[model samples]
Target chain A: MVNYLAGLDAVFLALADPTRRGMIERLSRGPATVGELGRPFAMTKPAITKHVRTLEQVGLVRRERIGRIHRCTLAPEAMRDAEEWIERHRRFWKSSLDRLTRHVESGDKLTLALTEERDE
Target chain B: MVNYLAGLDAVFLALADPTRRGMIERLSRGPATVGELGRPFAMTKPAITKHVRTLEQVGLVRRERIGRIHRCTLAPEAMRDAEEWIERHRRFWKSSLDRLTRHVESGDKLTLALTEERDE
Candidate 1:
């Protein structure tokens, strides 16, 4: 069995929360300071800080502090694994369904041919 | 703020578990019976069932009972929202980075012109 037990688990868990996903959405626009990242939320500074910490821990966001100002930036590479996993699964499912469709179509053709022979 | 509080939360939460991810990976190839889905794991049948139920609740899997056997299938559409979320962020991040790169390159060209004039 293929195991995605490392960073993917952390990435998905961090993304499971709406606050963090919102932070990611904001940072995806560009890097922002802690206050800026928290602007749209009614959350306390501490709560937003906690959510950013979760993203930082998951390697999804990088934080750098400069004299009381912490800037958060999206580490886009961090999402690569999770993205690839979903892409791979989608591809597999699509291809499998295509195969299933082809098989069913061929079966129908066979049935039609048998019926035609019986009619003749 | 873009709030992904609904199906996206459940989707990412369900994906956070490796076992559930594995089950998804299996079903992506095609649907399977509960026994077949559990074949690769050392876990109990109930454990596998629990994991499948979690996936089912999240709309990532569809479960159907045929006699005593339960058929588990991938609900690929359930992943579309989560996929779109990542894709949107990725597109924004990439485009923003591109803009940043362009800005920096333009600045570099200005600096080069200044240096050339100084050399002249």
Candidate 2:
């Protein structure tokens, strides 16, 4: 669980940046060289590299070097972890709300029973 | 879109902290007072308050003063935004992979046709 939370932390941090999200989107199409990844963004090569490194750190993207070229692909599995985390919490809250509704209904019934007993 | 991205940034940043995520989980059960929210954490009241404030800033939890107590409730809508963002990308990647598979299949067919023609 500690490792999972840590992985979640890294994933959220990596996703917080618009540029990084764009990179992930671009990579989703297929693997691309660093130059191809940087082409759409109006940023320096180092800036793009930093964003790529952040994605790599979170395991969101994988880099493989073929000759002098660095090819990056989207590691969708890492993204699945983040998605599952959010999905778990979303379901948690939904069930929680259901429970809260049931609790309130039971409380109302209990109150009604007490009032009837008092009157009797 | 910029506003949406900025909101996403705040939401992800707020969720990056385990403490804040815990508070969110606690709030999911139902509305709770500040004291109740702080009960699970080992941190000082002030520290817990800071985390609550961060969550409030991102609209993840709503705070309302009733009598002398402050009640915090899970604002699950904000969470939906984050979930939707991730879901969108997840779908994007899934479709992109489908397209890539089709492209590769077509390329293989084209290569086979050329080789057959050359042999003939």
Candidate 3:
């Protein structure tokens, strides 16, 4: 459980940056060399490399050296845990809201009955 | 676009902490008083308050005062933007993988044709 939380921490921290999110977006199209990933950004090569490193640390991207070029591809499965975490909460909240809706729709008869029992 | 990214940044940062995530989980079940929210953790009231503040900053929870007590409830809608952001990328990666599978299944005919055309 601790390790799971740590993984979530890393994933969320890695995704906190817009530059990193943009890199993921580009990688989603297909794989690309470091230079290609850096092209769309105004930052220097080292700066882009730093962002890529953060993503790699969180397992969001996998890098391979092909000749002198470093190619990066989206590690889609790394996102599964984070996606599932969010989805679980989303479903929970949705169901909670549904329950709340039903309670409200049922009106105050239950509340009144409980109050009467307490008074007795 | 910038504002949207900022929202994501805040949401992810807020979620990066396990304590905050735990509080969110509790809130998922129902509304709770500030004291109730702090009961499960070993942290001080101020520490818990700090976590709650971060969550509120991201609109993840809504707090209201009933007399001297503060009631906090999960603001599930606040999660909508973050959920959508992750879902979009998740869908993109899934489709990209599907395309890759099709390309590999089709074999090297396209690759050979491209190479021959380049040579000609």
Candidate 4:
């Protein structure tokens, strides 16, 4: 789980750059050949290729050759992993806040109750 | 939006380190003084202070000094931003796959229809 979170952080950071994120947004519509992916950017194909390679390293995108053209597609599973981890922990915070709210209103140990509920 | 996404990437990356993530996990249970937050790690308090400072920079935590004790609490909002962004795009991928599955089964332009569905 620890390593997985680190990988997710790497993937998202790789995607964080404008060029890389643009490549992904373009690829999302359909698979794109490397040259096609590069046309929108002012940078050279090699530069874009490096970005794609970084994305590939983090498992956010995959490349395959059809004839001489290398096509890229979104790798959705890693995105899902990141989403699920964030959602799980965010809910933990939300529930904690909710219990705090209830306790403040009613003068009760609602926080304790919520923890006990989780214990079951 | 682009800058916001970049910030999200930075924040998550900052949180990726084990010591940093450990600080967050502990903070989630309750607020902790800086010295208390550093006890689990073998590193010096200055090193741990640096980690906590990084977390604070990314808005994952807030530090408040009550007397000499610097207490840190989970910020929570930044985590929500990262979670929401990941979840929004992940659902996009899942729906794309579902459309692909249907198209493959029915031999129709389900992908096209899905794109059109988004247009509405």
Candidates in order, TM-scores: namely 0.80, 0.77, 0.79, 0.73
Which residue pairs overlap in candidate 1's backbone?
none
> Where does the lowest 10-residue lDDT sum fall in candidate 4 chain B?
B111-120
- Model 4 agreement with the true structure over A39-89: per-residue lDDT tens digits: 777998789889889888989888877567676767768776666666666
Per-prediction count of colliding residue pairs? 0, 0, 0, 0
Candidate 3 chain B worst ten-residue window by lDDT = B111-120
Candidate 2 chain B weakest lDDT stretch, 10 residues: B111-120
lDDT score for candidate 4 against the true structure: 0.68
DockQ of each: 0.31, 0.31, 0.36, 0.22
Task: List candidate 3 segments past 4 Å from native.
Answer: A1-4, A98-120, B1-4, B98-120
lDDT of 2: 0.73
Candidate 3 residue-wise lDDT, B1-120, digit = tens: 324467888898887788888878877776666667777779899998898888888999888775676767788677777777777887898776675566547875433322321211
Q: Which stretches of candidate 4 lie over 4 Å from their true place?
A: A1-6, A95-120, B1-6, B98-120
**Best candidate (score: DockQ):** 3
Worst 10-residue lDDT window for candidate 1 chain B reads: B111-120
Docking class of 3: acceptable
**Between candidates 3 and 4, which one is better according to lDDT?**
3
Tens digits of per-residue lDDT, candidate 2, B1-120, equal 223468888898888877887777777766677777777678899998899998998988888775676767777778788888788777777776675566457865533322221211
True contact recovery of candidate 3: 0.52
Report the lDDT tens digits of candidate 3 across residue range A4-68.
Answer: 46788889888877788888887887666777777777999999889999899899998877567
Report lDDT per candidate.
0.77, 0.73, 0.74, 0.68
lDDT of 4 at B107: 55
Model 1, residue A57: distance off in Å is: 1.6
In angstroms, the error of model 3 at B67 is 1.5
